[model samples]
Target chain A: MNITVLLKQVPDTTAKITISGGKVDENSVSKWSMSPYDEYALESGLQLKEKTGGNLVAITCGPERTKKMLTDAAAVGADTLVHISNDGVTDSTHVQKLLAAAVRRFDSQIVLCGKQAADTNSGSTGPGVAELIDAACVTLVTEVNYSEGKFSTIRPSNSGTEKVAVDGLSVFAFDKGTHELRRPNVRGIMMAKKKQVESITSGDLGVVLDSSNVTLNSQNPPPEKPAGQKFEGAEHVNEVVSKLRNEANVI
Target chain B: MAYEALDFYDVDSLLTEEERMVRDMVRDWVDEEVIPNIEIACREGVFPDEWRVALGEMGVLGAPLKGYDCPGLSYTAYGVICRELERGDSGLRSFASVQGSLAMYPIWDFGSEEQKNHYLPKMASGEWIGCFGLTEPDYGSNPGDMITKAEDMGDHYLLNGAKMWITNGSIAELAVVWAKLDGVIRGFIVEKNDPGFSAPEMKGKHSLKASVTSELVFQDCKIPKDRMLPGVKGLRGPFSCLNNARYGISWGALGSAQACFDSAKDYAMSRIQFDHPIASYQLVQNKLSWMLREITKGQLLAYHLGQKKDSGDWIPEHISLAKMNNVDIALEIARVARDIHGANGILDEYPIMRHMANLESVKTYEGTHDIHNLIIGRHITGIQAFTREA
Candidate 1:
């Protein structure tokens, strides 16, 4: 069983962002690393490939500079890499269509992706690709097991939890907080340089999806969260709970 | 300007991919195997004897020297391995340096082919541990005033002397004993099982508690004449080994300094005082900036010196300069880092105190800070200032 993990390179979460001149300042972003959620997807792919005798392919959709993430993934034991070099595409629907067209050329049996990209938080690609491929889709999946030509997925649901079994090939959008990512050893990173990385262009796929649906209105910094209120003594617990239920309205 | 341009020297790039891989492997091993047990080992004041064979299996015993079952890595990579191992504990790095630089180097560089073939492989595999016996009870900084002697016994040589502060002496299976044979200093490989040989542990050591230091006594010890090193015969033989160990000290000091700096930096950011993090204060920032500057400079110096050694252009005076600069800077960084931690720095919970204690030994061992300064002074002024008799 050949596994293909779709990884999206996002800015490091620990990076301190600065806003100046009505735009995000790139100078403040010091280092580039793999997105936290996508790291889980990469770990899952490596684990599955290690357990089953198969090849693990890492696919990314971004600009040319994003190849570093692919190279890092290869260092962590990804057998192959596919980079979809495109200029600009913010619409989730357009990205899904493009990736689906490109993935159709490969012999991918299990497709894995993060639930959302950290930059935009648009959790629509997994379901979109499942729709394009006409396969069963599982979102927010935390655990996955494949045996006897079937895929068993465990994921959280609105009503408690749920488990679903899908036949044949499938797509899974893994949620964060599933498991801690493993650090790659030096030997593994050295061997990764020799791994095969095949770069594919959207034009080569012979399909141009419609990207006219969405337009960028404005990009700005998110407002900082308010400092949390501290409570002291047993009497304040009742007040805090009341405020959380009535004033904050989160409970 | 530009946040004082804090330098995290890119010394790692000087190494080849394979060499860097060896460095990273040992770094991981030290972090996993050594760091976790360091506190316990230091508290017990006993070295982790189990890691000897394990470290040998990892190719650390004779990592840089080529041939005879050694790892054959570059000098830069060996420096990196030393730096990482010392980051966990200087005692651990001391074990590797003594085995690789002091003991194995002499046999490989000066020993007969038969001697090299006999001892190098066993020492490399950790099947036999080795120590270099050079520092005598009377000779610490000055090695020329030695009284240890070896008398010719036809087929065998009778050796009589006592060596002090010898690392790995108590546990070593073989010892590379340096003694004066007919007014000429030479190296002789003496097995521990040899008659009239004894290594007793030195007690009451406050620093480098996790390493074994012993007094090697050779009372009429008879060693085979063939074990005598033929290529080197003089003070230069042991001085060259001392140079090698000092080169490693240049890099090892940086590891301890970096660890202290990192701890202090983290503590300053999170530790609260005056209703705000200490990092917000200019005074704390000043201390941190100073440490960063020193660490950066020391790292760059060690890296370049390692490159020089790799290219076979390194001089003894150059090594003295590096050793002098890095060890002094490391001791200062440890002190400032401890001051930033305030009362907590005195405790072992923070590594500043431990590093502060260990740097004491690092400063004194191989060559003291004052000795190295004299070496640099001699190079500049064309006069040797270390000897008052002259």
Candidate 2:
């Protein structure tokens, strides 16, 4: 079995957000780091590789900077990297197509990705790739256990926790919780220096250029709320109720 | 302010992928594990003994050594590792430096195969903590003139020596003690449990407070004759260990400098004065620019030296140059950082004064800054300066 982990380079969440000309001014970002859920997904892929003897490769659709991100993945545990050279392709739909093509090229038995990217908050790529490649899809999966050619996945359900089983190959969209991200060991990091990362252009993946259907809209900062009047617990309950009905007009 | 490891000259690009990863990983580890606890540790004068397992798990102990389940990273990687560790606190870096370069290196470099097989693996896994015993009560720079002696008993060696300023001394399971054996300086692997051996904590030290420093006393300490390191004789054994340690300090000092510079820079930029950020002041910019300039030079020196170490063409004097230069700049940068913070720099809330005080020890240990200049001087002059006074 061959496992593949998908990673994305997202701006550090703690960065102060600013808008310029209807889009985020990326220059305001202090740092770029691995998305939190993708890190969990990578951990899942590593675990899958460890349990089932096979190479775990990481492939990402990112720009030149993501090369380091892929190498970093290798440093943590990935065996190899295949980068779908990012040429400013922001369309999530196109990214899914490219990922599906690369998954086919590697003949991966299992492909794992985060349920949602932190930057875009667009959660379509996981199931989109699964649909494109005709593989079993598990979304919002929190835990996965592989035993005897079967995957036992655990995810949250309205009733409680839910367990689902999938046979053989599948695409997993992870939603954090449970997995502990392993730090890079010295030996793996050293080997990462020698690990070859195969690069493929979008054209080689047969991804056709098309005008993105989405139109740019003006970006604005969220509206600031008026300062709320503080009540002195039970003593001000009557006043609070009157304010909510008269001033807030919520009654 | 967000502290990114200063790669002022795009130095990370020059580093190998593995090296960069190793550096960044250690940095992340320190930030997550050490930063929150370090201030209290320093204030209380307690070492974070709790982190020993993580440090060992991280392969920080003897990280450059191969085998014994060690990480065996490059020297430059090790340098950057020290840089990252010291950025949190120099005492933390000293703990690692003394563990790897001082304690483990002597065993790996000089111990017999049996000793190596026994100790190296355990040390790598943090199952055992070790400290080096070289600087004695009467000896700091001049170890050759020391009086600590190991007598050759029929069944074992009766080692009678006292070592001072030893890191991890009180907590170590083993001590790589350097003592005179029959008028010849020899290194001994002294276990802390040996009879008549004691490591007493030296208290009230204001500098390097985040580490354990003690005096190792041996009142006829007995150990198996086989425990003596068989590889080298005389001061060369301990001097070589010191040389290895100095290499770490070279980068460790730069880490201290980077921390101070980060605090200083961030404070200047955000701190309002005269209705404008102090960073807009010409004097503040001058200080920061100087720090940037010196730190870049130090980075280049450490990087190139690491490359030389990896290529197997390294010399000790180059390490001396780096240690001396980096420490000097770091202490200066810390003072300027204090100036930038005005009054808050002195508080435990910031790391400037802590690093400043710790650099005083770093500059002195692993060969003093002046001693390094003399070491470089000796290399250039081809003449022994110590004998000129004689």
Candidate 3:
């Protein structure tokens, strides 16, 4: 079996951000690490490759700096890397179409990606890509087992929980708890510097889409939540309740 | 006794595979060479001189300095080596510390190009022993009060001073001595064969017994003017050396505490108390848990500080905090570990007593607990609390 894990390079969540003149201050934003959920996906891919004796390919779509993320994944035992370079991936549909077209280029058996990126929290891209490719899609899978050309996955559902078993050539949106991410040792990191990374431009795919419709509408800072309101003591509890009931009219 | 999982704590995470390999190499060396003979060496109150050449052969001397056949390793790697070395005995680590951090670092950092080319490679190969002379009889904590004077001669400098509590002083071929010249502190590379230079071994030290500690005396010792370190002036040179040594101590103390914790934990699990293993008791579990927590915290602190040092942005106050926090916790862990061993704790056959005694020196040397607290105080309050007037 051949496994391909899709990784994305998002700004580290711990990074402090500043917005001035409707643009992110790049100078203030320091790049320190990969996304945590994507690390889990990479770990799952490596484990699957280890278990099934298959080739693991890590794919990413971003600017040039995304190559570092791909290289990091390769250091953790990914066999190959496929980088799809473009700057206009804002919506799920556009990213899905782009990844689907790239996936068709490789004869991969199973595809995997994180349940959601910490940056956008859209949680749509993996399912969208599976839909576009017309393959069996499972999301929020916390555990995975593959044997005899069949894949079994478990995920939480609104009612309780659900289990799905799909045949070969499926896509999975893995949760963070799926597996422990292996830290690349010094030797592995050094070896990663020598691995081959193939970069493909969207133009090379021979498919043209209307990118103007996918253009980002000015990025803005997230709105700050309101500060907590403090009540003095038990004596103020009734007063706060009355205010909520009468003035706020919630009761 | 076998090592417990908790004894490793955050140690493994902080090391790169290369650094871990270096650590494992040193660990294997200590287990094979030092641990078996440590008690005998301590009883004799002398470090085996043969191990000096052996450690030199193992590339443990002057590891972090770049160029000149030194290991040229990352600062964190040096810290890991120190930690592992000190785990066997502080005496062994002290020998390495004097050669590496105190002696070689000053030369690498402040010496002239000529000085580095001549001394670093020889020292790296362990063909020579080196020691630092900074602490004076009158000035224990207050180095600025040093009255050691260096007068200018036509072709050589006439030096007059006495440095106490110098490590490896008796056997050192090269010495970096700090003295006041025209009311300015300056560093000079003094050779042992100089006409007026003498090093006498200090006697009757209960702690760091297996290590050599001595006093250096210079009376009209004529040193060539070229030997003066031109790059550094005043107390900065020696203080910087202390900062480097203190960073290693922060990690090394953890090694000692870990050994004690492992020994105690194993004893608790195996040694029967009232027909059951003491480890089954809640009190023993509490002691074990606390040791683990403190060791883990110290490990994380040292690892982060090592990263900062590697990045070339470490400050003295950061090192002070790590040293202060780690040594304090290590001492506590040693005490609790001793208690967990009960009667066996006081025996020299066990490591708990030796670790407890050595931690006393670790807490005092480099910087005392109160001194480090003042350092942190100055960093936090923007005030110099160490000075009486300030």
Question: For this target, which candidate reaches the highest lDDT against the unseen true structure?
Answer: 2
- Extract clashing residue pairs from model 1: none
User: TM-score of model 1's chain A, to 2 decimals?
Assistant: 0.85
For candidate 3, the per-residue lDDT at A104 reads: 71
Give the Å error, residue A93, model 1.
6.0
Among all windows of ten consecutive residues in candidate 3 chain B, which has the lowest summed lDDT?
A: B1-10
lDDT of 2 by residue, B1-390 (tens): 346666678987887767778877888888888998998898788887777888887777897888877668788888888999999998888888888889899989898999999999999878788999988877787778888899999999998878899999998999999899889999999998999899999999889998999999999999998899999999899988887788888888888899898888888989999999999999999999999999999989888888887888988888888889989999998998898899999898888999989988888887888888888889999876755573
**Candidate number with greatest DockQ:** 2
Q: Candidate 1's error at A217, in angstroms?
A: 8.2
Order by TM-score, highest first: 2, 1, 3
How many pairs of residues collide in each model?
0, 0, 0
Q: Write the per-residue lDDT of candidate 2 for residues A116-229, one digit (tens) a residue.
A: 998888898889999999999999999888998888899999999999999877989999859778988676677777888899988898877576786657768779899877
- Model 3 per-residue lDDT tens digits across residues B249-337: 99999889888988998899999979999999999999999898889999889999999999988789999999999989988999999
Cα error of candidate 3 at position A181, Å: 36
Predictions in order: lDDT? 0.82, 0.87, 0.83
User: How close is every model to the real structure, measured as TM-score?
Assistant: 0.73, 0.91, 0.62
Which stretches of candidate 3 lie above 4 Å from their native place? A1-251, B1-11
Model 1 chain B: weakest 10-residue lDDT segment is: B1-10
